[model samples]
Target: MKFDPNSNLVYSTDTGRISPSQVEKVIPEGDGIIRIHKESKGRKGKGVSVIKGLALDEKNLKTLAQKLKKQCGCGGTVKDFNIEIQTDNRELLKSLLEKLNYTVKLAGG
Candidate 1:
């Protein structure tokens, strides 16, 4: 990540900046912030995992996913507009991101 002191904005080497316009969480019908959940759709069916929230792009998502993957000692990646992890450590990830002012919600599960 790159920090432009003049603008007081922290920039990512990939996503450039962590701005509100860069992150988005879609709420399904009858869902609110706390209703968020992690979703996994394998070859079988969709299962709810431990996901706090989601980011919108590969650049920002990859950076965040990498950090979580490292901390959790697992593998994770960014695909489409979703950040997917191989472990079930959403609580840890939530705390880490909260330090960066990212909002988190537990949905579905």
Candidate 2:
């Protein structure tokens, strides 16, 4: 509980690190499976279509999100390995993804 400047020791190992541990880049698996769903709980009943389980790197994911947003004529964003489109158009997204050769699944009540 006392500061010891003379001691050659570190009080905290992660004082100024961005990430606690190194995150290895993921290699996307074959014909990655993508799951889409509609979520409205946190958005005050304005449901947004959430796409998950896409085995793509960050760059590719971002590009895909942009394309999908344009095709759907809506706005969207990519975050934490998932894409969220600002609409409840699951079928349109599913078909678009399938055309890109990715296996797609719909989830949520």
Top model number, lDDT: 2
Query: 1-109 in candidate 2: lDDT tens per residue?
Result: 8976875453346664344244456655645568898898988888899999887888989999999999999999987788999988899999999999888999895
lDDT of 1 by residue, 2-97 (tens): 755766455789978687666665532222232224666662554434443453445666787788778778876665555666755567766766
Q: What overall lDDT goes with each candidate model?
A: 0.58, 0.85
Error of 2 at 36 (Å): 0.4
* Candidate 2 residue pairs that clash: none
User: What are the TM-scores, per candidate, against the unseen true structure?
Assistant: 0.52, 0.74
